[model samples]
Target chain A: MWHELARPEIWVPWLLGMAFGILVGSTPGLTATMAVAILLPVTFHLPAMAGLAVILGVSFTAIFAGDIPATLLRIPGTPASAAATLDAYELQRQGHGAPVLLTNLFCSAIGGLVGVGLLALLAPQLARWALRFSSFEYFWLGVFGLSLSAVLTPGQAWKGMAAAALGVLASTVGWDEVAAVERYTWGRTELFGGLGFIPAMIGLFGLAEVFRSASHRLARRPDARLEIRSASSRALRTVLAHPRLILQSSLLGTLIGALPGAGADVAAWVSYGLAKRLSRRAQQFGQGCWEGVVAPTSANNAAVAGAWIPALVFGIPGDAVTAIVVGAMLMYNIRPGPNLFHENIHQLHLLLAIAFLTQLFLIPAGMIGILGFRLFIRLPHSLVMSAVVVFCVVGAYAIEQKWFHVMVMFGFGLLGLWFDRHQVPVAPFILGMILQPILELNLRQGLIKSDGRFQAAWERPESLVLMILTLAMILGPAMWHVVRRIVAGIARPRTSESSP
Target chain B: MFSAHPARTDETAAPGSNRGARGGVSEPTWKALEWTVVGCAVALTAWLAGGGRSALVLSPGDPGPWLVPWSAAAILAVLAIGSGIAGLVGRRSVGAPREQETPARPAGRWIVVLLSAGYIVVAPVIGFGVATVVFVVSFLKTTSQRWRWWSAVVAAVALTLYVVVLFEKLLQVPLPRGSIGW
Candidate 1:
């Protein structure tokens, strides 16, 4: 893997990825999808590995850097990194920029390493197992993924279910997955195939953020200036002192990463949740807490690495970002799946080596970013925000050269803005959108395999376990809430009497 | 509308007061208006869904694209209903105005909205390149670059060139060419 690092073809992707990563990461509306989309035309001229290198590299770094503005300013750069706001901005206010950026870089690197390691280890086994999966299993897998999303997003569970239902319904547009008969497409040829993911992503994540950003006429709070009073060594020591926290988070990140379709935001939230529950100083979490910073920062980065395993081993993109990577791989005539490792072992090693090296650059790159944040942050929010909106529009249009995609982006952007105002979570919506098609495709296939018997979902132990987990995911939260309410009710009289 | 608890003057302080007292309506009045808007939205969603499946389809399809549209309509209906309910609930609980804080409105809001609307309106007519150049320049002028007229011009020129040169020239992504020539 190390030997492949110096190859010129490797550097082509590396440079391209780094430049695009910085651009997309810096921009609010231009997501990794749009970045890769604009660059997709560029990939036509390059080899598969080199192309994949550029896209995946951008995907990884862009996602990492997306948190910068979110931390420095209140704007969440990417939908996936929005979770950073709860603690990151607070840390910035507390003058923890040096530590926060250092932790982000360190944790991201560690998480990526962990993710790559897991991808190397688990993807082949999962792929082999996936081959045994019928349509029924796929359906269950889809359900399981959605259920986990609902379980993970930090808000009303019903809202998540609502978002997931909407996504499933959206996927049901155009045609039925099995019969290939047109279903909800209306008369539009674009609808004949259903809503494209890139437009939807750009709309939901990009255009929506643009509109929402417009609502906030951001004033230059003099504090928006990037101030790093401490050194990197101090930040490094603080993170190292929390070894247990870091290890737990890295593992959590890897696990979330491995989950098909679950992205870094989800990973961060899950790790944050765990970190809060397990920490001795759990109450301090929203108030410049480093563990709060470490959990999501590490997990999300790791999730990026984790996303690759399924894409490489099973040919199923774990997330939208990796879908681009998978697409690049296919362009090279190098098919994904277990055979990919054996057939193009050198390329796989090269890719792995590149992933490893991106982390090493983090120290220098991140330092430059920290120093530049003041100047970058000072750019008029109106102009930057407008650019973001344009990027989203152009990006959606570029996805398929259709106006409908742009429309979808705007529609979703409005919806996202509304949800933000109402405190309804957006995470589930993203998960639902990502997982719905997989669920629908799998469910129908599974049903066909099982001769329309629902019981077939339980026939396989793995499927059954996944189903149970889904149910548990739903019922556990409800049960806990009910129990808490009941207990509180029971204690009300006693507490009132004692207080009086 | 349930008016069990009348809004006090201070509860009305939220939105209008937050806007520095020039806001047209009292805080309580705005809250009521917000409720009405939410109620109207719900009614609209229900109305949209009232028709048969074909009526639901925004596009049209075999088996009808109404399935998802109807689903979205239903969700939106529910959300609207919930918003109205929450507004009423907020009114009841606080007995005063329930404070719903929005982000401080910057002067840039109107400019941005207008600019964006203009961009969308002009993009197809003038082509992306031309429309984009105007939009970027106007945007920079409206925002932080008052003394730096050249900065706006430079940014607009540079951005257009960068996108055109990169996507069109090198990447060959087929950007919209203006009818007015290069």
Candidate 2:
């Protein structure tokens, strides 16, 4: 690994990929998935290790660059950065854009390093543990994740749950994954493949923000400038003060990211919710709290590393990005799984080293991005919003070469507008769309394996443990409220009786 | 310089004002809308459930296709109905004030939406590049009175060319092209 890093061949592509990733990511409607897809063909010409390095650099840098837009424009460049928009945009509104950007960069690097360390140290043990998880356990995990996302949203929990239900219904639009039965295509060939998640995401976050800006008539301030030196000092102090949060979010992100279907988006959302739930200053979370920005930013970057664990160890892609990586590996005549560990251990080590080197390169890459994109913050609002609309159209169309997708984008844009007006959170809806198929597939598979007996499915120790945790996650907050009420009632003064 | 405080004159400012005011929907109306949403969900699930084996398609060991969707819809319906009722009862008990509503700003939003829809419809006919130029210039001019025609034209031309060159020429992702190839 050390020898590989010393070579210019390894580091040069990493640097160039990082630079390209930042440009693609900071643009609204352009996603990490699109970046990887666009660059994957180019990597085919390079050596396998160098190709892997470029992909790693792109994925890592793109996730961080997403925060740039989320903070500056209240638009999440990628789904993973959606949570960052909650507080990061608020901080930006409070004239803390420089600090927020700086914090995002620093914590993202720290989180990536921590994730790489965990991937290096604990891959085997964690893979073994993950193997113990059956479909029943996954079902519970999916429900728990979806429920937490719905309930932890800032406004009415029921509204969020309703939106999630709608999203799940949307997910069921195509043929069933297991049954091969056409469910809700309504006889249209385009509907057979179902709604593309990227198009829907582009519509919901990107186009919706355009509509919002139009209504509010938001104008960019020409005088706004990034104060990097002063903001960097303040951001450094803020991050240093919360050492525990940094560590906890990183670990949690790694764990969630290691789940086969769960990716950085889920890791970021779950970590952000957990931070808000556990923090002493919870009320300040959506009101520009630095902890809010730190948790998700760190978790998302760490998740990039965590995603590599399953991809290398078990040939299971942790997320969409790794799914693409698996394809790239196959193209290079290198297969993943246990046999690869023995036959191509050197490549595995190279992959790990590339992941670490990408983090090392993030510092310079992120600084360049922050400095370069500051000019974007000062651009006229009309011009910026106009560009966003154009990108949204192109991005949605580029996902699949069909005009139907552009229509889907427009339809979801209207839905998103309604959601925004009603104060319903969009994150849970996206989570539902992502997790619904997985949950349903696992549920049916578990039932099949258990001979259609619920008891049999629950008999496994892992299943029972996950079931208990799901129950606790669902009911624990209500129970705490009850307990607090009881304590308050008992502690009431006797003068209350006389007054009554 | 002390003087008697002026009497409050806003009727909606008084306690227990339930009527729709300042563009805000009344409490009962809001509750009705919630119930309507719940009702639609229940009706859709019921319709789906009525299809039974034909629509659901259960295999030898599978739990069936409609099971998860039906169950999720049922749960959502129950939660929505429960929340609607609870909101009504809670509002009565707490005497919560009606929410203030923002003044309607529908024209700009509607124009943008209409322009976007038109752009999509026209893109296939006139080409994506030409339609984009029209949409950008029209959208900017419609949304803001301060926008100069030359500025809008310049922005529209630059953006269309950039997207066409990057996506079409470089990435080789085929974009919609009409009679005029470029």
Candidate 3:
């Protein structure tokens, strides 16, 4: 894999791409999708490996870059950074700020390696057959992912589902992108862009958190001055302690990422939820537990790698970022689809190598980014909170320089406060918003083609599997108790009879 | 379907038991809050869903943009209503109230939220830069005992300058200039 990349032309663009990924991804309102799109024009003159190096480099690093803000500030720098905000921020506030981020960075790199490794080993098999998914399969895929919201909630499944439905409703504020039909915008031009995602996110995760943490006790917290000294060794030791967790999260992230319409955000949530469900220390989740920090960090970056699978194999984007990458590939005359492997097997292999090696650069690049932010965290607690508010205002405003977006941020901030007070899990609400477009688009398309038969969602083999999974998710808890009771009842009688 | 309020005393109530309800209103309060939020969502979605059909309605089955939201609203309403009924009867949260460890100041949270909301409302009118300075100074002076008013003013000015330089000069974002300007 290293043999072909000896040329400067390849590695230079790769480094540039990773840098751009860090810039856009760490900055609020900018996205990894934007970074790749910006670099697409430059890839035209580059070699296939070089072009892939840039695109793949940006996606992988951008996913991790979001964690910088997520860990240091309570705000998620990117949508995928939502899960990272949970444990990393908790750990940061616990005076393990420097170490948690470094560990998270390593986990991201490890996750990237796992993703690229799987991509190399499984791409041929997956691309050849498993990607025969269509609208029917996609509609089910959307539902399947949506069902995972149940897993996301620590409370009732119904609450999660309702919250998710609310998220879908929030997404409905704008015009239907495909149909171009006006929705609940109510003649307001500002509403056409829908509720600004960045504003809503900053409100829900960032400002809402700021408000919740507004205690006088919080005003006098210690900075990470001493922790920065031992950050390196601590991070190394922490990453070393969690091989099984890292592997599980990465694998889960890769598989979810490989699914079209599901991206790093969903993968992170599902991975976190799965880890929580399986952990003996599940009670420690969201309270600065290392598993909480590791699971989503590893998963989100792995998801970046996973997203390339459907894009390279099925000509369908695995997420928003891959949609741009697919376009960039086509611009370089690298057509993707069923015939992609047959046409350019060597090119594909080189691209995978570039992606795999992209993880190596993530460490130095991510360390520098976090260390830079570490300086900002040295400020007193009051000043840091003030700075956060300033940044949130600017970030929300910088999106479109519109006060309406700022208002949207404030409105969602209020809502988030209310949700926090009321004990509603806002995580599902975000998932719903992200998945609504994919779910509705595919469902409507499937129905229109299948003549409005509700059963059309499960007509395909893939759809059938997803349908079964969704049902299992919804019904699994109820059935589990019944089975346990029945077995206990049978065993009680047998034991008594034998004893007598 | 249930409350997400913090567990009362970590008394370790059994699942589905009303021990939380007996101890405090945390159980009923949460259920009330859940259905209320869901109820509001139902109203908003139902209202929007009714109006979702634009001129792009292709057919009866293909309700165009109306279907997704309308269906979501219907489902939410059903779930909330059903859950409300269940709450009225007997069902409740499955676990103990979540334990909350973060030290909370009821007053401080409101202060931060009010100051932030005020900043948002006044930024465009008062110029983003100036509004930020006032907001930061006021917040620091009011909230933190470490900084006196004069020191708070100094820090606020410095912070505001950094924001202006970063956004307006370096990044070249055209920030709003109110009557006070720069």
Candidate 4:
């Protein structure tokens, strides 16, 4: 593992990946998916490790960088990084120094290292355990993933479930993955498959925001000029002070990332949740607490490193970015999966080394970003919003030649605006839309394979544990409320009856 | 159907619960918005159920696309009920409106809504770039800009390049050129 960390062949590609990640991550509509897709054309020419390194670098950087605009502006750079909106911006608003940004970068780097360490130490065991997840287990896993979102979202669990249902509905709008039956495209040939994730993301998060902004068009302009004043040395020390949080978030991130389809977003959210729960200063979290920045930032970047664990060991692409990298590998005639590790150990080790080194480029790029935030913020909202609108139109058109994507983008923009107006959490909707299909497809196929025995899901302990976690997720908050109510009732004075 | 004070006391400040009831004028608008959301959720749920792989399920059907959305609708329904009951019981407590000291100069809130709605309707027809520039310029003018003509020209040129070069050339995604034949 240490030997893989010292190779020069890895450094070059890693830097390239860092640059790609920061650039894509900085932009609003261009997600990690588009970043990976854009790099695919270029990556095809590189050596195997080099190619995978670039993709991985881009993926991690983009995921972390997505927080840039989300914090600086209210625009989320990527769908997965949306949760950063609440806490990150709040911190920025309160005038926390630039040390927070540097700390986030430092923690991200540390988290990446920790996640990589976990992959190196634990992926083999996890992969072996994962082998037991047959179709039935996978189906349960899918349901559990969707349910987990509901659990994490605040408010009525039923509402979260409803958002999940809406997401599942959104997913079903495209073609059925296995049988190719048209689910709900409404007769357009484009409907033959279903909604593309990229376009939907652009429309929902990007254009929807445009419409929402249009409503308050002439209200007080946002504070675009943000100045951060923290030295790197001081920021680094502050991050070190919170070693426990760093350790916990990194470990949580790796665990979430190692799960086949759960990506950095889930890991980050989970890490944020854990950090909030564990912190003595939890109330200060969304108000720009230092821990708020550290938790999600670390978990997401760590998840990026952890993503490769599943991708490398099991030949399963961890998330959309890894999935694209897998496609690039197939283009080179290199098959991924369990056998690839044995067949391509030297190559895999080289790629791992490159993944580690990508942090070098990420640090400098992140520093530059911290310095540049002020300038970026000064740019007028009209100009920024106009550019965003242009990006949405082009991005929609690029999804396919069809003009219908524009309609889709606009349509979802309205839906997204509606969702925002009501203060419903859009995270579940995105999570459900992204994860439900994977869960459903795997389950339906598993059930078909198993001949209708629902109990088959419990055969795999991993599946069983996840299922239990999902149940706990639903029950935990409700239980808390119930317990709180009971305690309050008990604490009430008996004299209330006499007084009344 | 229980009612509470219109203004919440300090003792009742729970973390995850709604605060004291809003004023009567605002209450109905919020309630209307809540029910509107529920209506959309239910409509979406029905559409999902109608298009399900298996439609023979009970009222508590399979956890398809509809199930989640329908559940959201149910939650909203609960909120709506709570709001309605609050509105009814707090009718007597509905505080009188504060009198304005002078003749009011309207802030043009409806015009803002109309302008946004108009922008959306015009976007596809005029092309995003053109429509966006026009909207921005018109918005600035409506909000009391002195240099409307200059703003319009500058915004148009800048937005066109943004749409053409950045989006079309660099990203290689096409946008509607325009229905006006531009």
Candidate 5:
């Protein structure tokens, strides 16, 4: 790994790839997945190590760069960054854009390093543990993730649950995963596959913000500028104070990302929710809290590394980006899974080295992206809003080359505006949408496997543990309050009787 | 069917004093909307459960596709109704609008919504590029006091071209070409 790091050939392509990724990830419609796909052919021409380096560089850089738009505008450059948008946007509105961006950049690098370190040390062990997880366990895990939304949301939990339910309902618009039945298409050909996630996301965050800004009577303050030098040190100190949060979020992200289907997006949401639940400043989460920004920023980048675990260990693609990397590896005659480690030890070392170096390269690449986008943030509000609208339109339309997707984007934008006005948190809805299919699929499968007996889910040790955790997460707070009241009642009588 | 605004304690306050009730929908109206949504979800789930084209028995006693959706709908229905009733009763007991914290200006929101809708509706008839230019110009002119029509047009055109070139030409991701073509 050290020997490989010394080579100039590796460093040049890695930096170039990171630079390109920053551009793609900062754009509203162009996703990390799309960036990797576009760069796939280019990677094919390079050597195996160089190709792997490119993929690693792009994936990590893109994930970090996503926070740029998410901070400056309310629009998330990638789905994973959506969890950060609420806090990032609020912070940006408060003229803390530079500090927030710096925090995000710093956390991303640290989280990426942590994830790679864990991958190097624990891939096989964790993969073995993950193998014990059955559909029943997965069902409970999904429910647990969903339960965090209620805890994470401010004000009314009921509203958050309602929004989540609505998201689940929206997710069920296409063909059923289990029965192969067309569930809720409403007779449109495009509806056969369900609402496109990218289009819907783009509409909810990107176009909705445009609508919001356009509707505001007061023009944006023209003097607002990105002040990085003064803010970076303070931001770094703030982030450093939350070492426990950074570590926990990174580990959790890696675990979730190691799941074959659940990727950085899910990891980010779950981590953000968990951070809010555990934070002393939970109330400040959606109102521009630095902790809120750090949690998701760290988790998303960590998940990028975590996604590689399954791909390298079990020949399973952890997410869409890894799936492409797997394809690229196959083209290079480098097979994944256990045999590859024994046969091609050098390749494995190279991959681990590339992951580390890619994260290290993020320091410079992220600064560049932040400084470059900072200039754009100084544009007048009218021009910025108009450009955002155009980007939203183009982004939605580019999804499947169908006008209907754009229509879906428009509809969701309207829904987002309504949600915003009504004080219904949008994050829960997104979390529910992401988790719904996984939950439904697993639940139905568990039921079938159990022969309609609910007890069968509890028969497996992992499933039973997950079930207990889910129950505890749901009922613990209420039970704790009740117990506290009872104890207080007993103490009050004694204290009153003995009063001097 | 429920008023979102409780009877105003300050009669002297302006007509649009309540910022809490968005779009001027009263408290009861919002609650009724929640109830309506819950009812529709329950009905949809019940309909799906009853009407099945194909039934598969994974095991001798297994319920098929309807089970998950039905269970979810049941949970949602219960929660929604519970919340709705709680909110309604709570509002009735405290039957007064809170002091207005901010003045409502709904005109801008409606204007933008309408402009966006028009842009969506007109894009297929006129080309995407042309519709975007028109929408941008109209939106800037409406929202900004010092709006310049020519600059707005130039900016809109340039932005549209940037999108087309980046997405359509460079990335080869086909964008919407309306009936008017390029």
Candidate 6:
């Protein structure tokens, strides 16, 4: 594995791909999927190893570079980086920019290595486990993810849920996947397939950030200056201190990523939530806690590696990136699935090497991305904000080359602004939109299969577990409050009688 | 609608918190915004419930397509109304107003919104390259009055060239070239 990486043919395309990934990924709205797709034709004629190198490099490095904007600005470059906007940006606000990013870089590499290692060792078993999930389990899983986002968002739980509900409604705009009918298109051709996620995401995170910066510029609040400098110190000590956290988050990320439809974004959020709940300084989580940065950054990149497990074993794409990758693999006549292990074992080994080496390459690639972003932001704040607005426009337009998407971006930008003012966290809204299809389709399908008897869900053990977890996540706090009140009332009466 | 929660003013809200007086657009009329959202949610719920129930696809066992839409819209309406009512009652209970807190500036914000809207309207007509250059220069001058014209033009042209090379030349992803073309 080590010697294969030493070959110039192997390393050259890989490095070039990493550079491209950093450029595309750090820019809001130009997702990793688009980058890989755009590069697909170029890779068609290249050697198989070289083609794999470009795709794998972009996929891995993009997940890491996404943390750049999420930490430096409140905007996340990709959906996977959304978790970073919570704690990483807060830490950056608190002037811990250098150490926070450095730690993020280191942890991402380690977490990715751990994920690749696990993928190499346990592909078959994990693939089987993930494949066992049915429509019923999928519904419960989506609910659980939604419930987690609601609780994790910093606001009134009801408000978070409201935002999530609004998001789900927004997602219902296109075709009804099961029924083959439109719900909210209102006859616009652009609304047929639905609002694209990338445009809406940039509108919310990118354009919304620009709008805030404009407000701050007018308000004369000079609080939006770049904080990328002041140090270029090592974060090795901090990383060393959190060995257990790095391991745990990586493992958790891998497990979640192995689940079909549960992508890196969900893994990051789940890991961040778990870390906050277990930490001694839980109260300081959203208020500039470093563990918050580490957990999500580590998990997101790890999930990128874990996403390849099902892609390799079952030929089912674990996420969008892998779908494109598996498609590319087919073009190369190196098919995915169980037979590939027997016939193309060497090709599998090549993928393993690329995944492992990609982590090592993240250090240089991430630094360049960070420095480039710093230089960009170091421009005059108001100019930078204006430039970001233009970038958002271009990014939105680039998707399918449609002007309607630009309109969608602008509309969502306004909605994001409105939501921000109302203290509705946009994170849950985005998650809700992403998960709505899975939630709605599976829910109806499960109901249909069970003849509308909801009680039948309890028959499947996995479904029961997931349903229970989802219920607990949504209602646990309120029930806990009721239990505490009952216990207090009983104790108060006993004390009063004893005193008399 | 503009009543204040004197004890817990928007400025006093915790950072990353649900509370606080948000500056900017919502400051003047959050009640209307909240109620508007609630109204929209309510209308959506009614539409989904009424239509889906009457539709033939909703068989005895299957919930059909509108189940999620109705449920989600209903929940949103309920939650938004509750939140709006709480906000209203909190304002009314305060009685006397305290010293007013400064809202986040909306002057530049309005300019940004206008500029963005203008860009969207004009870009397809004028093409991405020309439109981008014009947008950047106008945005810079409007936002930063003291800035030099030459520098702004230089920056605008540079950004245009960069994007043209990126989207058009390198990535081969075309941008809007309008009727006359760039």
**Using TM-score as the measure, which candidate wins?**
1
lDDT of each: 0.63, 0.75, 0.74, 0.61, 0.73, 0.73
Question: Which wins on DockQ, candidate 2 or candidate 6?
Answer: 6
lDDT of 2 at A301: 93
Model 3 residue A448 lDDT score: 77
Please, what are the lDDT tens digits per residue for candidate 1 over residues A174-251?
665444456544577877766765566666666655655554444343333333444467668867888787778878
Instruction: Find the candidate with the highest DockQ and give its number.
Output: 3
List residue ranges in candidate 4 displaced over 4 A.
A1-103, A154-156, A177-181, A215-249, A252-300, A303-355, A453-466, A479-500, B1-148, B166-182
Rank candidates, TM-score, best first: 1, 2, 6, 3, 5, 4
Compute each candidate's TM-score over C-alphas.
0.75, 0.74, 0.70, 0.67, 0.69, 0.71
Over 4 Å off, model 5? A1-108, A119-124, A217-358, B1-62, B91-105
After superposing candidate 1 on the true structure, give the runs of residues whose Cα lies further than 4 Å from its correct spot: A1-10, A23-48, A66-100, A175-177, A219-232, A235-242, A257-296, A307-353, A454-461, A483-500, B1-101, B106-114, B141-151
Can you rank all candidates by lDDT, best first?
2, 3, 6, 5, 1, 4
Q: Cα RMSDs of all predictions?
A: 8.2, 8.0, 8.5, 9.6, 9.1, 8.6
Q: Residues B129-176, candidate 4, lDDT per residue (tens digit)? A: 677677667655564444468865686577676557754575465566
- DockQ score for model 1: 0.14
> Which is the leading candidate under lDDT?
2
Q: Each candidate's fnat, in order?
A: 0.15, 0.32, 0.43, 0.03, 0.25, 0.40
lDDT value for model 6 = 0.73
lDDT of model 1, residue B91: 40
Decide which is better by TM-score, 3 or 4. 3
Q: After superposition, how far is residue A442 of candidate 1 from its true place, in Å?
A: 2.4
Calculate DockQ per candidate and list them: 0.14, 0.22, 0.26, 0.08, 0.19, 0.25
Global lDDT of model 5: 0.73
lDDT of 2 by residue, A1-500 (tens): 68866778767777888987897687655677657755665565467787789899999999999998888767677778998889988887777888888899999999999999999888766555666677887677667767766765556666667777777777777777677777667688898888866677767766776776566534233233666688889889988988899999999999888775467888999999999999999999999999999999999999989978866765555766775676568768887655666678788788888888788889889989877765654556677677777777887787657889889988888988777656667767776777777689888888888778878656888878878876786678779989999888876765576685
- lDDT by residue (tens digit), candidate 4, A367-407: 66655544554555555554555556555665555667666
